[model samples]
Each structure stands twice: as C-alpha cells, then as structure tokens.
Target: MTHAIPNVLTIAGSDSGGGAGIQADLKAFSALGAYGASVITALTAQNTRGVTAIHTPDPGFVTAQLDAVFDDIRIDAVKIGMLANAQIARAVADALRRYQPKHIVLDTVMISKSNHALLAPDAVAAVRDELLPLASLVTPNLPEAAALLGEAAVTDEAGMIRQGEALRALGAQAVLMKGGHLAASDSPDWLIQEHGTLRLGGPRVPVKNTHGTGCTLSSSIAALVAQRDDLASAVAEAKVYLTGALQASDQLEVGSGVGPVHHFYRWW
Candidate 1:
C-alpha cells in the first residue's frame, strides 16, 4: 500500500555541528518517515563543544523563508526552535497566525547544551505573549519553564505540574514539562492539558553524548504528531524513539566533546 508522508517544517537556527537545530529536526523527520522543510532563522558557528558565534537573519528574510515554504508545501506540522531575538520571534508568530498549521511544537530553546545563550532576554516576551498562544504544544525544560513563568526552576514532580498548569494558562493547548535536568536515576516528563496530566517515565540513559536530546525530542514529537490522530500517542512514540536514540548515542564518534544521538539507529 502507498500513502502520502506528512510534511513537517522546522523553523530554527543552523547548527554547524549538525547535532541540533535544523539539522537534527530534518534528520528526525526523515528517520520517522516524514518529509522535512526548514526556515533558517539564524546561523551558528558551533561544534559539540559550544557555540562560538551566531548570525541571525533579518526578520524580513525570516518572514520570506516562512512564506516560501508555506506557499509551496502543505506543512502538516511545525517544530520551532531557536528564535534569536524578539523580532524574529514576532515574525514567526505572525506567520504561524497567517498560515495556521495544524500542529506547532515550540521547543523553548533558551540556552545551548554548552551554556551559550541562544535566546535574547528581551525576546522572552515575544515568545511568551505571541508564540505561546499559538503553539499546539510547548516543550520546555525546567529552566525554560521557569524562564517562561518568571520563577525559579522547580525541583520536584509537584513543581512540574504547577508550572505545567501555569504554562497551559498562557494559551498553549498543552505543555510537556521535561524533567531531564533533575538529578535522578529516572527521567520523568509530564504532559499537562485542560482535562488532566499524563506522566511519562523513562530510565535516564547514562550517556554523555547527548548534545541535541531536547531538539531531537521536540522535533520527533512534531514529526509523529503529523501522522497520528492522538497527540498523547505521538508523544509516547516519540519518547520511545528518542530513548532508543539516546541509548545508541555513544556509537557515533562525531566530535571530541558531546556527540549527537543516532538518528538513524535502526539503519546503518
């Protein structure tokens, strides 16, 4: 039997290291059997070590890129990553409003794995005010959730639910509160929505080569959601794929520092 593949778009920066950003998103899309499109909002000179320099496209150019993709392709879903500043964030939010894709997964990428500041402090407002209301699902780490709500990072399961509910109030239909930052043997994530919360638990993979785990997870969700009717199932399937990728991450010798997960782990 033949069927059309879902087309997923990633609006993010370019990671020269290829471990994260547009590169990782496209890889996840392909690995999950979805067609991928990209709109580059910024460019970074980075390796697994850290981001050294960043170059952001003009907001007008960002809008142009969005128009170019939406004009031609039927985008089934959108995975949004690093928006360099307020202008770019506003631009992306506006385009989303116009095109109105069925699913938008906003990965609140505030800092890089190596502690590089990806989002400008001023841009937080744009993301919270304009982007949050438009997202179908918002994926935020502990620090990002805190940043979004202007509070300290939560340290327990109760705090995760508290912040998740607050984030949902900000207009996103659902919030996935990631607890990978917690110092525990098991990694826990909570999916918070209007009706209730769903807890997803996984053993933490003991691997240092997790350079793009967050990017990979959010994009995977976006890609899977494009095909499945149920968001929870898509999220669960995405997590399974990510866990497998993380377990196999050490196989790839990409860089001297942190390395990328095996996106095509099932293949060569």
Candidate 2:
C-alpha cells in the first residue's frame, strides 16, 4: 500500500534572515517529515540582528494567495504568523472561516526578538478578537499572552495556567502558553484544550539562536497535526523536537549577530 505525505500550509511573513516566519515554518515542516506550502503575508528587511522595515502585501493579494493554495491543494493543517496589520489578520481570519482546515496553529507573532514590532500597534484587537476564535490552537509567549489578555505578563507556571484558561475563554479551543521568557529553571509550556491540561517542561538549551523558537514550536505542532496526531500528542512531540533543535543550534553558525535553531538537527 502507498501513503501520502501530510501537507502543511504556513501563512505568514517573509524573513530575509531565513531564521523565522515563513522560512522557519517551512524548515520545521520539512525537518519533521511533512510537506510544506506558504502564503507570504508580509516581507521584512531583516537579519539575525534585527528587523528594519516591513511591507505587507495588499490584503486583497493575501486573499488571492490563500485561494490559490486552497483551490489547488488540500492543506492538512495551517500555521499562521506575523500578520503585519489588521487587514492581514482579518484576511487570515476570513480564510480560516472559509477553508476551515482540519487543524490551525496560530502563533500570535507580534514582537521580534530584536524588539521590533512585527504586527502593527492597532492590529492587536483584530488578532485578539477576529483570528483567535478560529484557531484550533493558539501559541503565545508570555508577552503575547499578556497583550491578548490586557494584563501584566504571566511570569510563572501558575500564571501560565491562569492565562491559558483566559486565552481559551477568548475563543481558542486550545492554548499553548510558552514560558521561554520566564527566568525559570526550565522551559515550561501549558497546553489547555478540551482535554485536561498538560504541563510540558524541559531543560532550557543555553543557546543564542532561539530567535525563532516560538515559530518553530507552533509550526512543529501544525506539522504533527497534519500528520494525523492528536492535539496533545502534537504539542508534546513539537516540544521535544524544538528542544533538540535548540540544543543543536550551537553546531551551526549562519550569521554573526544571533543565529537560528538547527531546524534540520536530525541530519547532523
């Protein structure tokens, strides 16, 4: 008997650095054994150091891109990132309402590691209101979680659990609250879905190239979901894969400032 490779779609921005956004998502999908496709919502003039400028395609073009992919291929899952503006966010939300992919992992990508704003300041409400509701899972770091909730940043495991519940109340069926920002002993994340909550914890890899950790983790979950794994199982597998990639990041140097995680760590 023959089998088909899972097809995962990433609708996000372009990172000239090749370390985050659409690039990282594609790399994660391929490294994890899934077929990947993309619709670029915005383009950024950026590198490992920081982002300088960003340009979002006309929102109409974004819709066309989504249609082009959906009309042609059957996407098993979708991963959304750096929408750039309310228009782009609404476009993504509208597409999700239309195509209704089996699984959607929305990484509420707002601020870049270099302290640049990926999404416009005014677009925050659109993301919290429009897009959050459609996602099968919403992956937000501490700051993003706080922004979505209009509260102070969640700083501990208990805070994460509370915010995870709050995020679900905002509309996401599942919430993965990433604890990478906490100055804690380990990297802990909370996954709250219809099922019971799971606390995912791992030793923090002491590496500098964690620029795309959030994108990588969210895309990894989307890829696993596309491959027919359950939501909780997908989250668990993605965490393991991201940690390994972080641990192996020291093995490669793509740029001078900060580097990217070794998305293909299994190869080396």
Candidate 3:
C-alpha cells in the first residue's frame, strides 16, 4: 500500500551554488519528509564567494509556474523566498491571493549569505504590503528587519522583539526574527506573537557552512506545517532541525566559501 505525503511549495530563486534558494528549500522539504515543488523567479550566477549577477524571470512566466502548480497539485504549505523585484513580488502576491494555501512561510530574503542584494531597494514596500500580510509567519534576519523598518539599530534581542512587533503590526500574523547575523554570545532568536514573545536561544556554531540556514529553516517550518503541526510547534521543530543541520555540517565541504548545511545528516 502507498502512503500519502504532505506537499510543500517553494517559490524562490535558483542558486547555482546549490547551497541556497530553491535547491536548499527542496532539500529541506525532502529531508523533512514532504513533497517539494518550486516556482523559480530568478536565476543567479553565484557560488560560495558571492552572487556575480542575477536575472529575474519574466513576471508572466512566474505566474505561469504558480498556475501550473496550483492548478494540479494540492499544495499544503508555501515557503516564499527571493522575490528579486517589484514585478516578481507583485506576481507572487497575486498568486498568493489566488491560491491562498493553508500555511505560508515568508523568508524575507533581502540579502544573500554571500553579501549580494537579493531584493531591490525600492521593492521593500512592495514586499511589506503585498507579501507580509499574506504570510502566516515572516522570518527576517537582523539586516532584513533593519531594511524593512528603515532603522539601522535592530541588532539585539530587545530590538528584534520590537522589530517583530512592528512587522506584525504591519500585518504579519507572526514574526521570527533570526539572530544568526548578530554578534551575540548566545545567538537568541525571538518569535513574536500577539500574545507574547518566546525567545529561542542556542550557542552559535563556529562553522562557515551556513549559507542556506535561513531558507532551510523557513522551508522546514513550511514542511512541518504541511504535516499538520501548529505554528509554534512547527517553528520550534524547524529550529531544532536547523541547529542539528548546522552542527552536522562540519563533515561536508561543498565549496571553498560558506557551504551548505547537511540536510540529510540524520540519514547518513
């Protein structure tokens, strides 16, 4: 007898380095025992060093991909990443309006791990207006949160909670402010809700192979949600999975620069 698996969709860019973007999301989904689907919005000439260039796919083609996926598949959750431009962001927003999947995890991928700008400067408002409200949870790193709020000092846990609260006020039901970029002794991320905030803390691993940690975490949350976990439980489980992935990444050498996490570490 065949068993049915939960399906999760990732709308993101293609990372040539295979460390992030759609590649990472698909890996995380499969690692979490979910069926993964994708709608690529941009292609990047990137490696561990940096993104040399980016080419945004046509908005019409992006919509076409979404239509194809939603027209046939029963997508349980969606993990959105790397909408490189306003047009792509608008298209994705339209698709979200059309499909309206049960759980939407938005990874506000403003900048890549290699220090390249993934989202345009002018598109921040578009993302906030079109996507953030539609997302069940918005996961943004320190820099992305700063960019979103136009504030330069959201670098601590208190600032993160404030920023998360501001983002939730802007319309996100929940916010997960990632602290991996912060230079703290204990890297503590805050999950802010209407009720209160829960701090998730863990020691920072001294590993350079953390290129796709954000994408992986958000995708893992989406996968867990697809499996019917509640929002808080899904986020908690994804954090655990990401911590393990980071700890187990020491064994692999994918690239000379920042490398990919070991998504299948448990199996191997």
Pairs that clash in candidate 3: none
Q: What is the C-alpha lDDT profile of model 3 across 1-268, one tens digit per residue?
A: 0236988999999999998999999999999999999999999998888899999989999999999999999989999999999999999999999989988999999888767899997789999999999999999988888888888857677888998999999999899998887877777889998889999887888877888999999999999977855788888889899989999997888878888899999898
lDDT of 2 by residue, 56-125 (tens): 8999999999999999998899999999999989988898899998788999999999999998888999
- TM of each candidate vs. truth: 0.98, 0.97, 0.96
- Clashes per candidate (backbone, < 3 Å): 0, 0, 0
Which candidate model has the greater TM-score, 2 or 3?
A: 2
Candidate 1: deviation at residue 73, Å?
Answer: 0.6
Off by over 4 Å in 2: 1-3
Model 2 TM: 0.97
Q: Which 10-residue span in candidate 3 carries the lowest summed lDDT?
A: 1-10
Instruction: Kindly list the per-residue Cα lDDT of model 1 for residues 1-268, writing each as its tens digit.
Output: 1347999999999999999999999999999999999999999999999999999989999999999999999999999999999999999999999999999999999999999999999999999999999999999999999999999999999999999999999999999999998988899999998889999998899999998899999999999998985789889999999999999998899999999999999996
By summed lDDT, which 10 consecutive residues of candidate 2 come out lowest?
1-10
Q: Which predicted model would earn the best TM-score? A: 1
